[model samples]
Target: MTDIPNIPFVDLASQQNRIRADIDKAMARVLDHGRYVMGPEVAELEAELSKFCGAKHSIGCSSGTDALAMVLMAKNLRAGQVIFCPSFTFVATAEVVAWLGAKVCFVDVEPDTFNMDPKALKAAIETAKANGEDLAGIIVVDLFGLPADYVSILKIAEENDLWLMSDAAQSFGARYHNAPIGTNGIATATSFFPAKPLGAYGDGGAMFTDDDELAEDLRSILFHGKGTSQYDNVRIGMTGRLDTMQAAVLLEKLKIFDSEIVERQKVADRYTSGLSDIVTCPHVPEGCQSVWAQYTTRLPQGLDRDALQAQLKDKGIPTAVYYAKPLHRQDAYKHNLIAGQTSDGVLPVTDALSLDVLSLPMHPYLSDDTQDYIIEHIRGAISDLS
Candidate 1:
C-alpha cells in the first residue's frame, strides 16, 4: 500500500487524442448546423454504420438500451410472450424484454467464448414450451465483442418460429464465418456507450436491418410514430432519437474503426499468450473474430477473486467483473426467470459459472509497458495465493 498507481479499466484518452482534430471539427459543424434533434449527422451516421455492418438500413436511437427497446416495441412483443437470453451479459439485454412485460428465460453461456450456449438455448426453448411460456423471440448477445454462435442460434430461431435479434452492443465490429453481425438477424442492436469498441462521446445506439418493413416500423416508432410530421402519431411510439452531437462524434470514431479492430486482435493475443496458463482465458472459436472489448480471464480454482483484484490494484493493474451474479438470481426478474435445469432439477453448470469470471483491463491502446506491468502483477497475485 505504499503508492497506488492509476490504471483505468479503459483508456479512452488514447483514442481521443488520435482523433482530436476531427472531433473538434465535427463538433463545430454540429453546433453551426443547429439541428440537435434528428440532424443531418444522424442520417449520415446511420448510412455509414449500415454500410460498415453490411446491413440495408441502420436507425440511430437514444442509447443501446433504447435501441433494444425500440425493436421490442416495434415488434409488438407482449408482456406474457417469453424471450430467451443469456444471464452472463449486461442487464440491458434482458431488461428490455421485462420493460415490455415479457417473460425472461435465462440461458447459460459457454465457459470459453462467453457467448450464449446454443445447447442450453435449445434446451431452454424446449423447457419454456413444456412449461407453457409462449416463446416469441430469442435475443443472441455478442458477449465481450465475440459474436455468438449465430449460425446455429439463428437455426434454432427458425425451427422455433421465434424472432432472432442480435444484441451486438459489445460486438459491433466482430464477425462470424466472415459475415458481419448486424445483417444476420431481423434486427441487430448496438450501443455507442463511450466504452464500446466503436463508441460515441456519450450515450447512443443504432438498430440495423434489411427488412424494409421492420426498418420503417422502427423509424416511425423511434420518433413518436410520425408518418411525415412530428405531430402525426401513426403508431405507439417513444421519444428515442439519437442526438446530433453523438452522431458527429461517432462519425469521426468510425473512420479509424477498421484499424482499431486489427489492433484489438493483437492485444487479445498478447493477453492469451502472456497469461493463458495462469487462468482460463477467453476463447475465440474457429471462423470467428472478436473486437476484444474485454479480455476477461477466469480465476484459478480455490483463488479468492476479491483478493486477486486487490492484489492487482495494489500493483497498478486494474480488473472488473463482467457480471458477478446471474439474472435468474437477480431481484428484478427472479419471479419470472426460468433457469436452465434438467428434468430432475440440476443446473450444476450455471451454478459453477456465476462465481468464476473476471475481466482484465483491455482496450486497443494498452501499451507494451502497461501490459508488462499488468502481467507481472497478475502472475505475482496468482503465484502468491498458491
Candidate 2:
C-alpha cells in the first residue's frame, strides 16, 4: 500500500480555522460581560436555534443527556411507566428514561435506514399492554443523520395516546418531509457535542418545542425548578444550564452550519457513487435530507469487518464502528424487554446491524482526493478479504 497521511475521523481543526476570528470575537464578548452562566450569548443562541429549526422555543442545556433528561423531568416521567426506544443507538437515549425510574423497552430498527422500526414500536406497545404495563411515550432516535419515519411513528403515538420525543442529537441540521427535524415530534432534543454537525467547542445541547407550557416547564426544570427566581424553588430540578462560553462558540458555528451540511452531503454522494457496488450504502428516503453526521456503511454478508478495518488502517485510512454491540446486548441493558422478542428473544434487524455497521472519515472539509483515496483503499481491502 502507498504511504499517506492519516485522515481525521472528524476534522474540527479545519472548521476552527475557517471561523477562528469570529469565535475569538464571540468569546471575547462573553469574557468582557463576565456572565459565564445564562448570559446574553445563551439567549442569542437559543433564538437563533429556534429560527433555524422553526421551533417556537429553544432551551440550551449543559449536554445532550441533560437536554433529554430535562424534558423527561418536565413531563414528570415516573416509575413503572414504560418508554419505548430503539436498541441500536447510543445508551443516552435509554439512560435518561432509567434515570427517572421509568422502564425502557428496547425496540428494533429498520435494516436500511437504521432508524426505529414503527412496526416494532406498535408491537412493543401491544405487548406491554397485554402484560398490564403502563405505556407512557416513545423516544425515536434519528440514527446517524437521517430522520426516522416520523409520519408513521406519530400516527402510532396518537392512536396509543402517547407523546413522542425526537432524539435529534445527530440529525439537528436534517429535514423530514420538507419540515425541519426539531418541528416533527412533540419536543426535540439535539446535541452540540463537538462531533455533531452543528457542534460547539464543548458540551452543549438544546431542546425545541412549540408547546408553550412545556417550554416554560423546561426552563424552570433546568435551573432548580425556579418559579420566579433562582432562590425560589418550586419543583425538583437540576443545574442543567448551558455555559455562556459554549453558547458563544455555538453561535459562531451555527452561522456556517447550513453550508457545512451541503458539503457533507456532497461527500456522502461521492462515497455512495464510488463504493455502493462493494458495500450497502446508507439509504435516505424521499423528502428527507440527512446531515451525514457519520458516513456509516454495512459490510457484505460473510465479510470479515475486523480484517477490512485492519487492512484499511495499514493504508493510513481510519475507520470506526458506530456500535459493535446493540444496547440490548450490552451488560447494562441486558435485562430490558426487546420489542417483537419471540422465543428467540432477539431483535433480528438491530442484532444484525450491530455486527456490520462501519463509519468512515466524514466531515465537511473531507477533500475529494482524500475521500477517493479512502474509497479506493476500502475497495482494495474488501477485494482482498473476499
Candidate 3:
C-alpha cells in the first residue's frame, strides 16, 4: 500500500515559493522602514490596486468585512433601510448591513453562476416596498470567483435610485464584459484573506471606486473618521486600516496577479471538462472570467454529498462545502425572513445549492496529476453509491 500525497485546498506555498525573492525584499523593506501602520506600502499598494482594477481610488482596510462596513458607514445606513443581497454568500456581505442597523432583505441567487440574480433582486425590492420597507441599496456578491450579473443589476439600481456595491471578495481578479470587477458598481470591496486568489499574509481588504467624494469618505471611515488631522474626529468610525506589512506582501503578489488569473482559468477548464459528465461542473457565463476561487461541483440528486466527501478524504484529497446552509436558513437570520415568505417566496435556487454543492481543491498552482486523481476518486465514489 502506497500513501497518497495530501493535496491542499489552496496551495499558497506554491505561489509563495514562486515569488519568494520578491516577497522577501518587499517585507525587508517594510521592516527597515519600521512604519508598520499606514506606512508607505499601504498607499503604494492602494495606488497600484486602483490602476489594476481601473478605479480612481482604492482604500485599504483591515478586512473585507470592514471594507463593506466602512462603505455602509460612509452612507450612514440606519434602521428601517433595506439592502438587498443574495443569501448564498458569506455572512460578511450582509453582516455589515445588519451592524449598521440596516435591514437585509435576502434575495435568491442564479442557478448556474451562484451569483445574485438581478431578477430576484428586483423582486426583493418590490417585496420590501410592499411591506413598506425603506429600500436603501443593493450589494451584489461575486460568489465563488464569478462576477454577478452587473449589467442588469446596475440598471435596476439606477432605475430605483439605490446604491449598488460589488462584493468582489472572491472575484477580485475576475472580469465582467471585459471590464475589471471593481469598476462595475458604485463601489467594490474585496478580501485578502490568506485563502483568496490574491491574498496577503494575513487579513486585509480594499474598497475601489471612481467617485472621488465617496473615496474620501471611505478613507475617513477607515481611520476613525478623522476630519483633517488624526486628532480631529469628524464622525463615528472604527479601527479598520490595513497593516503596512500586509500591503507590502500584496504589492509583491499584485505583480503576478494577471498571470496567475490566466493559470487559474486553465485549472478551471480542466476541472469542468473532466467532471462535467459525473457531476454538475461550474458554469462561467459568457463575457465573464472567474479567478477560480473554488472549483465547486454539485453532486447529482439522491447522492449523499457528505458520504462522497468522506470518501475523498480517505483518498487524501480534501473537499469542502462552500455553504452547507444559505444565510436565510441560518439560525440568526431565520427571524429576519417573514414567516412563510422570502423575497421570492422560498429562495428555491439557494436552498437547492446548499444541499448539493461541494468544493474541491482549487488554486492557480493545482497540478494536472493531482486533478486527475481527484476526478478518478470522484467517479469511484459516485460508482459505489450507484
Candidate 4:
C-alpha cells in the first residue's frame, strides 16, 4: 500500500469556503436583527424553496424528523391506523409513524434502486385490510437520493385512497419523470442534516405541498398550534420551527444546489464506470435523477463487508453502512407491529440490504482526484479480498 489522501465523506468545508462571504453576511444580519426564532430569513427561505421546488408552500421546521412528524400531526393520525413504509431506511421514517401511535406496516424495497417496492406496498395494504386494520396512508422514502417508483406508488395510493407522503430527506434536489421530488406527493419532507446534498450548517428541515389547507395546518402545528396570534393556542403542536440562522445558511446553499447536483452526477458516473465490474453499484431508473446522497454499493456475496471497511481504513479511505439493521429487526419495533403487516413472510429484501450495503465517500465537493484515489483503493481492496 502507498500513500493515500484522507477524504472526508462529506466535504462541508470546501462547500462553505465557496460561499463564505455570502454565509458570513447572512449570519451577521441575523445576529444584528436579534430575532433568532422564526425571523425574516425563515420566511425568505420558505418562499425560495417553495418556488424552487414548484411547491405552492414550503414550511421550514426544526429537523427532518420533526418535519415528517408535523405533517403526520396535521393529518390527524391516530392509533391502530396503519401507515405502510419501507424497512430499508433510516429509523426516522418509521419511528415517526410509531410515535403518532399508528402501526408501521413494514414493506420491502426494490433490490436495484433500493426504494420502496410498490408491489410490496400493495400487499401490505391488502394484508392490513385482511387483518381488519385501518389503512391510513403510505410514506415512501427516496432511499439514497433516488426517488421511489412514484408512477406505480401513486397509482396504488390513488386506488386505495391513501394519503401519499414522499420522504425526500435524501432526494430533495432529485427529479422524478422531469418533475422535482417535492411535487411527487401530497406532502414531501426533507432534511438539512449537514450531510444532505443541500444541507444547512446545523439541523433543519422543510415540508412542501400544494394543498392550501394542509399547509396552513402544518404552519400552525409547527408553532405550537398558534391561531391568529402567537399566544392563542388552537391545537396541540411542538416547537418545530426552523431557526433563522440555519435558514440563512440554507438560503445561500440553495443558490448552488442545482449545479452541485450536476457535480454529484458526474462523481457517481465515474464511480459506476470504474467499479461496476467488481461491486453492485447503485442503479437509477430512466427519467429519474438521484442526488447520489450516500453513493452506497453492495458487497459481493461471501466477502465480509466489515473486513473490506478495515482494508479501506488502513489506506485512509472511509466507508459507511447507511443502515446495518433493518427497522423491523430493531428491538424497539420488534413487538409492536400489527397483524399481517410483515409483507407476506419476513422482509427478505430489507434484511439482505442491511447486511450488504456500504456507503462510500459521496458529496458534491468530492473532487475528481479524490474520487480516483478512492476508486483505485476500492478496486485494489476487492481484488485482494477475492
Candidate 5:
C-alpha cells in the first residue's frame, strides 16, 4: 500500500532523533567496558531507578513478567491462597499467580477508570471469607499509566493481612496524590517493555521495595537463590537478570524521562481535545497523573469499532485494541477460573470494555500535524456512522 500520510502507532524514531547522540555514547561506553552480564551498567541502572522511585532498593530483572514472578516467589504466598486482581488487566498479572500455584480470583473493574474496583474487591474478599477460602494478597495495577485507588486498596490489605503489590507496569512514570506508585505499595513491580512510559530498547524490569530484609530476599530470587555466592543455593529461584545492554539503553533514556512524560501528557491533552466530541475520552481520575502510555477512547453508542478501525486504517490512521478479550474468557485460563458468584454472561464492565474501547497512536513525539489528520479522519468516520 502506498503511504497515504501514514502514521505509526508509536513514533519511536522521532523521539530517538532528539537523543541519538547521547544514546550512541551510552551504548559505546558499554561496548568498551566488556562486561555484558550483570555489568556496571546493571548496577548503575538499578541505582538510577531507585532514585527515581524514591525507594531504597530497585532490583533489576529480565522482564516485567519475571519482575512479578520474583515478587510472588519472594513473598511465598502459598498454593490455594486466593489473590484478587482485575480481569480487565494484561494476562501477566494473573499468569504469575497461576504459575506459582496460587489461585487468582477475578474481580470486576471500575467503569470509568477501567481499574480494579475497590467495591468489587471488597465483595470478593467477603465472598471468599464466607466460603472459607484463604485470601493471600492483592495486586493493584496502575492500568493505562493511572494508579488505582491505592489508599482504599492499602486499607483493605492491612485489614485482611494480605500483602499488597503494585503492578505499575503501565503506570511507572505516573503519580498518585503527588507521590509515585512504588512508595505506596509494600513493594511495586514495573516493566520497561518497549511500549511502556519509561521503556527501554528491549525487555527489562525492576522491583521497588522499602523493607531491607524483603529487598534482600527478592535480590536472592533474581540471582538463582544464592546465599551471597553463585554456587550456594538455599532456596528455589529463577534466572531473571536484566541484560547489561538493556540497562545501558535505559540509563540513557532515564536522563530525559521526566521531559518525555511531560510531552506525553501534552499529546494526550491534544488527542482528547480533538476527539472527545466523537468518542468517550479516557478518564484519568482527579489527583492522578497518567503517563498517557495509550490514548484510548470508547466509541460512542451506535458506532461500530470494527468499521471505525477499518476507516482509520484506510485513511492511514492506525488504531489498536488493547484487549479484545477479557482474561476470564481466554482459552488458556478457563480451567483456572475463580470468578465470584455471577452469571456467565455478566462482568458487565469488563465485557463492554472489551468491545467499545480502542487505542489511537500515542507516544511522546506524535506530531500535531499527524494527530490532527488522525483526529479529522476519526471525526469523519463517526459522522459517517451517525
Candidate 6:
C-alpha cells in the first residue's frame, strides 16, 4: 500500500505565514514599549474585541479559565451554591464553579447540537431547589464552535432568576439568533489558545459584557481586586491579566478573524457534503452560525471509536475526541449532582455522546483536496468496518 502523506490537524502554520509580517511588527512594537504587563496593546485588543462582538466592554485576561473564574468572582459565587453546566464539554466549564467552592450540577446536552438542553437545565434547577441546594447560575458551553440554544436557555435563566454565562472558548466568532456569541449571556468568555478558531500565538482570553458595573468588577478582579490604587486591596482577586505580547498578536489576528470564519465555514460545508451519508454531521440551527472550531461528528453506533481513530492514524490522518468521559462520570466529579437523577442517574445523551464523538482536521486554511481526502478516508473506514 502506498503511504499517504500526513495532514495537519490544524494548519496554523499557513495562517501564521500569511500574517507573519504583521505579527512580527506587532511583537516588535510591544518589545520596544517594554510594558509587557497590562501594556497599551492589551487595552487596544480589548477595544477591538468589543467592536467586533458589539459588546459594551471587553476585558482581556490571561486565559479562558481565568476569564470564567473572574466572572464568578465578580458575581460573588459562594460555597454551597450550585451552578448548572453541561456534562458533554471541556472540564473548564465546571472547573471554575468548583474553584469558587460551589457545587456543579451536571446537565445533559442535546444530541444533535451537542449543547446544553434547556429541558435538562430546567429539570436540574427544579431538582436542586427540591433538594434544598442554593441555585446560583448557569454556564452554557458552545461546544465545538456552535452557539448553545440561547433563546431557550435565556428564557430558562430569566424564569429561574439565575444568571447566564457563555463559555464561548470554542465559539467566539459564532452567532446565536443573528446576535454575536458574546452578547447572549450576562458575560461571555472566549479563549485565544492556539487551537481555537480565533487563536493567538499563546494563551490569552477575553470577557465581554454589556453591564457597566459587572465590567468594572471584572477589571478589578483580574487586577488583584485593586481599589483606588494598586496598593489599595479592596476585594480578593487573582493574577488574571492578559500579557501585552499575546494581546499584540491577537490584535493582528482579529483583523482577519471574520474572513477566516468564512473560510472555516467553507471547510465545514465541504466536509458535511462529503461525509454526511456515513456520519452524523454537526447541526447548526436556523438563524445561528458556527465558527467551525472543530469539525466534529458523531460516529455510527456499535462502532469502536478508538479503532476508527487508529485506522485513520495509519493513513496519516489525525483524529481527536472532544470528551471521552462526561463530567458526571469522571473521577473528580463522580460525587457531583446530576440533573433529573433519581435512583438511576440521567444524562443519557451526554453519556452516549462521549463514546462516539470524533473531531476531524478543522481550520480556515484547509484546502478542498485535503478535506476531500479526509472525507473519503473516513467514509471508506466506516464502510469497511461495517
TM-scores across all candidates? 0.96, 0.97, 0.97, 0.97, 0.97, 0.97
Question: Best lDDT goes to which candidate?
Answer: 2
Task: Give each model's whole-structure lDDT.
Answer: 0.86, 0.91, 0.88, 0.90, 0.86, 0.90
TM-score of predicted model 6? 0.97
Whole-model lDDT for model 1 versus the true structure? 0.86
Pairs clashing within candidate 2: none
Off by over 4 Å in 1: 1-4, 338-347
**Candidate 5 lDDT tens digits, 74-129:** 88878888888888889999999989888878888888888888888888888888
The lDDT, on a scale of 0 to 1, for candidate 4 is 0.90
TM-score of 2: 0.97
Candidate 3 lDDT tens digits, 57-96: 9999999999988888888888768888888989998888
Candidate 1 displacement at residue 343 in angstroms: 12
Better structure of 1 and 2 per lDDT: 2
| lDDT tens digits, residue span 1-386, model 6 | 57686889998999999999999999999989899999999989988998889999999999999999999999999987999999889888888887888888888899899999999998888888888888889999999999898889999999999999999999999988887889888999999999998888889999999999999989888888989866788899889999999999999999999999999999999999998889999999999899998999999998988889999999889999989977777777655554444233488898888889999999998889888888888998999887
The true-versus-predicted C-alpha distance at residue 22 of model 2, in Å, is 1.1
The C-alpha RMSD in Å for every predicted model, in order, reads 1.9, 1.5, 1.5, 1.5, 1.5, 1.5
